[model samples]
Target: MARPYEPGPSTSLSTNTLSQTPSSPVPEEDDDSGAASPELPLTMSASVMLADLPRDATAALASVGGFPQEKVVVKFKPVGAAPSLAQELCKISATRKFEEVVRYLRRKLRCKDTDSVFLYVNSAFAPSLDEVVGNLHQCFKNGQDQLIVAYSMTPAFG
Candidate 1:
């Protein structure tokens, strides 16, 4: 059988021993020391400044160079009993808002002022009218290199 273990004496800590140690310094409290410390100037090394920035910040700065705007092709797919248009595909400026697509659909359908139209992408979800069409196309485009948008005269896909 193994002998029972015994703890070494150095493990014990007493208040008197802790106060008498040369490395420990006791803080002095001053009730009148309410003045704020002086502010330091904001200075950072190049490597540290780059490291502290968000990952996308560098990519965004790189894209600031001159870039030409490209048009995107949007293919409209009617759902349920929605009327089909003679033209199913249209090209729109990449920077145009999604509201332009909705307006174009309404005009093509000759819908009344009170009629409601719902637009969705990939038969999945409806995007906000303020969303950029180019961004949506870039993210949700189909294999045919076109943005597939499904529309209905009434509420179809939630």
Candidate 2:
């Protein structure tokens, strides 16, 4: 019969004292700190320096070395409390920045500097303004081959 593991003072038990196979290594009661315990590596901690990593992450965006030849179709979508555009669809140079789309929306809406316009792709996430439009379209375009951009006057998605 096995006794309850009383993990203190080396557990001077008559039954366990003469065991062949060693039990799991447990921390002694004297050890107050978890110094021997291993820690899990954080995903966010794994970062690369700018010098080590490429500036452009995608091949689609890296094609900017050549002249702006390809055009991506951008379809505007209105989110909660946002007004819709007169023309929902538009064609833009693939090499252009996402900032261009934001600027275009601002212009169409006649938004002042004080007015904030938030834009998201696929109504899921907001891309950086500096991100290339071609890369976004290539990665997240809808079935109709259109880059669906959802815009909102206020914060919509987390």
Candidate 3:
């Protein structure tokens, strides 16, 4: 059976202080001062920075690895009403629609028939705080409570 949890002797209290105070109990046994404490690791999911996604995700998913680069998923969305392409791209970034903005650029932005490519989101951005709170139960049950997606960004790697 697993050992029951105990309130460890207060490591933070100094031995001198304990000695001065007769009522205090002896210090708890410690394996080593340098040894790491038994603690839970953060439950956060890893995020995929735009540049790293293509090389990293593809290598792990062989189906993606050998496939043509053009077949890779492209996320984009248009931002603000703008006739100028640069303005539109700038608006996308400012709005934080990481996926949607990229998609729009892929289809619209061009130079000598070549496009200056990057990531974008089509949506408003990471979901609002209320939306996240609403999904908290589902997230917790699925071990995804720590997983947070920005309202505009579809979280490149979930």
Q: How do these models rank on lDDT, best leading?
A: 2, 1, 3
Candidate 1's displacement at residue 125, Å, is 0.7
Model 1 Cα lDDT, one tens digit per residue, 78-125: 999899989999999888899999999999999999999899999899
lDDT of each: 0.77, 0.80, 0.33
- Model 1 steric clash total: 0
Error of 3 at 44 (Å): 30
Provide the RMSD of all predictions against the true structure, rounded to 1 decimal: 14.1, 13.0, 17.1
TM for candidate 3 is: 0.17
Q: Candidate 3 on 1-158: residue-level lDDT in tens?
A: 43433434442444687566533233333677654344522112422346556765776886532322221222223333322344321222222333443344445544234433323222323433223222322322223222222122123323
In lDDT terms, how accurate is model 1? 0.77
Q: Could you tell me how far off, in angstroms, the CA of residue 39 lies in candidate 3 after the best superposition?
A: 20
What TM-score fits each model? 0.61, 0.58, 0.17
